[model samples]
Target: MSVDRDTVLKIARLSRIKLEDERVEPLMGELNNILAWVEQLDGVDTTDVAPMTSAVETSLAWREDQVSDGECAEDVLKNAPVSEYGFFAVPKVIE
Candidate 1:
């Protein structure tokens, strides 16, 4: 993609970056060079390669699926400033 000065200015505006006028020409040249390099990568062969998450091979360690209360109610309610009926009490906010 040919990144012109006008296109660079639009890109800067959209990205919310306050770029100086002198920087636009250099930035446009750099962006065009990057696009050209990426275009060159499209010709490489990778038909047999599988997609991978990491360069090194590894497996995730998963624990058993268990369902239970995290802790007894007594332990959780002990730290409350004001607890009633095994629940935290707060000042009334509604009229």
Candidate 2:
């Protein structure tokens, strides 16, 4: 799959990037090279290979879910610039 100048320009426009007319040719060539490499990878056999997230298999260590000490409403509202009814207060938005 070869990328032409028009395709490059269209891609640049879609990506919201402004590319100069002279830069289009080089970008097209680079994109085409990448596509050719992907095409080459299509010839490889991977029927026996298993999909993996990482090269080594490992399990994530996890801690037991247990609740401990928690802050009271007064403690939480102590640092607020404006608080009422044990909650942070902000300016009213609607009339």
Candidate with top lDDT is 1
TM-score of each: 0.47, 0.47
lDDT of 1 by residue, 1-95 (tens): 58888899999999999998889988988999999988987798879987778877888889788975677889999999999999999999898
Question: Candidate 2's residue-wise lDDT over 28-72, tens digit each?
Answer: 889998899889877889899877888777988887898666867
* lDDT scores in order: 0.89, 0.87
Model 2, residue 66: distance off in Å is 12
Where is model 1 poorest over a 10-residue stretch in terms of lDDT?
A: 63-72
| Candidate 1 residue pairs in clash (backbone atoms < 3 Å) | none
What does candidate 1 score on TM? 0.47
